[model samples]
Target: MEQLIIQLISGAVGGNAAGSAMKNLSLGTLGNTIAGLVGGAGGGQLIALLGSGAALAGGGGDIMGMVTQAAGGAGGGAILTAIVGMIKSKMSS
Candidate 1:
């Protein structure tokens, strides 16, 4: 549950950052945040499925594990936002 919350927050931040970094792929603040939330949840599940959790656990309670998880969430959020934004842009054209 804690991880989920972390992912959600990081995802929102990541989405906004990505939108600002690439206007061509910006989905507005709300859209970006919503997409990022979904992506973050999905990405967290994917990481669990991929067994990356074990690698992180090997560190035995270190900041790196938390950082890695946050990064994963952010990356997932940004990727999804960009993809959706691009698709929307293309469809509208």
Candidate 2:
């Protein structure tokens, strides 16, 4: 639950950053946020699964672990948002 919240917040930030960086792919604040939230949650979960399966699998009970999780979530969110934005842009054109 806590991790989910962290991912969602990070995802929102990531989405906004991506949007600001690429005007052509910007989906507006609300659209970017929503897409980011979903992407973040999914990405966080995926990372957690992979992380748990790896040798580095040490529960996210530590600061570094938490940071890694947030970074993964944010990165995933940004990528997803950019992909979606590009698709939308292409479709509209």
Which numbered prediction scores highest in lDDT against the true structure?
A: 2
Model 2 spans with C-alpha error above 4 angstroms: 52-60
| Residue pairs in collision within model 1 | none
**Predictions in order: lDDT:** 0.76, 0.80
Clashes of 1: 0
Global Cα RMSD, each model: 2.4, 2.4
Give per-residue lDDT, candidate 2, residue 81. 92
Which candidate's TM-score is highest? 2
1-93 in candidate 2: lDDT tens per residue? 667777899888888888989999999999899888988887777888886322223443666667766886798789889999999999999
TM-score of each: 0.85, 0.88
Question: Candidate 1: where is the Cα deviation over 4 Å?
Answer: 55-62
